[model samples]
Target chain A: EPEVTQTPSHQVTQMGQEVILRCVPISNHLYFYWYRQILGQKVEFLVSFYNNEISEKSEIFDDQFSVERPDGSNFTLKIRSTKLEDSAMYFCASTSTGGDYGYTFGSGTRLTVV
Target chain B: KDQVFQPSTVASSEGAVVEIFCNHSVSNAYNFFWYLHFPGCAPRLLVKGSKPSQQGRYNMTYERFSSSLLILQVREADAAVYYCACGAAGNKLTFGGGTRVLVKP
Candidate 1:
């Protein structure tokens, strides 16, 4: 089974710092997404990317957040200025079809903003 | 204003079946999904409950406002947090507070 790969399994950063989380979606997948889960909370959608551009984003994805498909296989989420509340587990997912189809999620990157 | 709701935890013995119940308030929801998550790992789609489907030992029954996931003959490895979500507007999913399953040998 092909897997979506994510870098930096865990990261700790000071508040107000910039952070970029990287993901390599499944080779044949067309849609990519970023989701976050605060400790003991349900997962929340952040953004969805398709055709090299953002398709949809939630209110949680504000000016401080941006997503880019920097290359053929790499999709990244950058937080311009991390706040303490930004601490959470960030998961990258990909699907061959629309998101209503099942999505394959990568082992999340734990971001701890201090 | 929670769109999804589920139990907090369930304990079961090995070889027993476990059922997790979920309810949603999203009136426009046409599909539901179930995901399994181990600590420190990404949640994996266990069953897509668009119209009630089964995969391996996992089965899902979906209704307009509620759904349930059944794990048949569960094993120790089946212990994990299970999440139920409803597809909302913009193709995004609103997840319920996950149910943690504890399986005893």
Candidate 2:
């Protein structure tokens, strides 16, 4: 079965550095999302992308955060400046355009900021 | 505020009986979900969107237990971590940390 795939399973970056987390969504899906889970915290929605544009975003997705689907299949989330609070597991998920289906999520990329 | 919860936390049961897992949420979210994960692996789709499916004794129920996945006549292979999520309007999902179940021989 097709599944969302994320790159750089783990990353370590210093405060104030930039980090790009990449994901390749299932080929046929249209809705894409980025979520993060701080250690011991619930998953929080960061942003959603469709048609090469962001559809919605959470307050947690502030000025320092951005998402781009540079290619037909590659979706990316970039953190312009990392902070200690930015340490978390970032997950990418995709759903069919119809909106009735569940999301398929990648294993995730663990981002660690020091 | 939105929250999903599974109180059992962990379970160890025998391989031939039914195990009913539970999920609760402060969210009156219309959509609920269940996903299963094997050790060292990512979560796999099991059931979603208030539609519960029954496959060889795996039954998902929405009306009761807030949302639940019932595994009948469990097997060793059924041991895994289970998670539940709830949301309204099919928007963002609020997931519970997860419940771990162990089916013994």
Candidate 3:
């Protein structure tokens, strides 16, 4: 089956540094999303992208965070200034349709800020 | 606030049937989905139920503001963390605290 691919399975960065996470959604998918999960916590929605713009974002998606569909296939989430609290497993997901359909999630990127 | 409730852990011997429950409180929930996650891996969609009936190995029944995932004839590979998520109107999902299933050989 087709899948969403995320680069850098694990990343360690210093606090206050900028980090960019990349994802390549399924070719036919129209909606893309970014979610994060802190250790032993529930998954939290960060942002959703459709038609090259942000459709909706959670409160956790603040000024420090930004998402861009840089190209036809690549979606990226950039954190301008990372903090210790930013450490989490970032997941990229895509869906061919809207609600009621299953979403495909990529193996997450483990972001660890020191 | 919207919330999902589930047991933190469950254990069963291989070949036993396991039923995992996901009770949610979200007035805006339009759909329910179940996902499986292995340690250090991403979550995979196991099944989704918009109504009370859907086709898949994961059976979902929504009643009285709660849903359940019934894993029939469980195997060792079925051991993973299962999460129940509610899909709101805008396609956003609020996930439940996961249930960890350990299958003994």
Candidate 4:
């Protein structure tokens, strides 16, 4: 089956640094999302992207965070200034329909802000 | 506030069935989804419930504010963290704390 692909399976960065996580959603999928799971915690929605703009975002998605579908195929989440609390496994997901159809998820980028 | 609740862990023997129960506090959310995740792997979609019930080896029962995931004849490979999610609309999902299943052979 086709899959969502994410780069940098693991990353360690200093607190206060900028980080950009990259993802390539399924070719035919339309909705793109970024979610984060803090270790041993529930998965939290960060942002949803559709038609090259953000559709909705959680409160956790603040000024420090932004998402872009730069090239129609690659979706990215950029954290302008990371903090220690930013450490988590960031998952990229896509769906042809909406959540009722479930989503295809990427292996995830584990970001560890030190 | 919307909250999804699930047990922390469940242990079962191989060939036994495992049922993970989930409940949510979002009264307006009717869409339920189940996902399975192995450590360091992507979360995989196991079932989707747009309505009340789904049929398959991995069955799902979705009520307006609660859902259950039934894994039939589970094997060792079925050991993983299972997450229940709900959304008021159709886009963003709010997930439960996840139930970790342990299958013994």
Off by over 4 Å in 2: B16-28, B88-90
| lDDT (10s digit) by residue, model 2, range B1-105 | 556777545555665654545566545566677778664355677777666666556677776437777777677788777777776554666677777777767
Candidate 2: fnat, from 0 to 1?
A: 0.37
Candidate 1 residues B1-105, lDDT tens each?
Answer: 647999999999999999999998866777888999888777889888568899999999988888999999999999899998888434767789899999999
Global local distance difference test of model 2: 0.78
lDDT (0 to 1) per candidate:
0.89, 0.78, 0.87, 0.90
TM-score ranking of the models? 4, 3, 1, 2
Q: List the residue pairs that clash in candidate 1.
A: none
lDDT of 4 by residue, A7-93 (tens): 999999999999999999999999999999999788998999888889999999999999998888999999999999999999999
Rank list by lDDT: 4, 1, 3, 2
Looking at model 4 chain A, report the run of 10 residues with the lowest lDDT sum.
A95-104
> Which wins on lDDT, candidate 3 or candidate 4?
4
> Candidate 2 or 4, higher lDDT?
4
Model 2, span A33-110: residue lDDT tens: 998889767668899888888888988999999999987989999999999999999999998852346678899999
Interface RMSD, candidates in the order listed: 2.2, 2.5, 1.7, 1.5
Question: On a 0 to 1 TM-score scale, where does candidate 1 land against the true structure?
Answer: 0.94
Give residue A6's error in model 4 in angstroms.
0.4
Tens digit of per-residue lDDT, candidate 3, span A10-70 = 9999999999999999999998899999998888989988888999999999999999987
Best by TM-score: 4
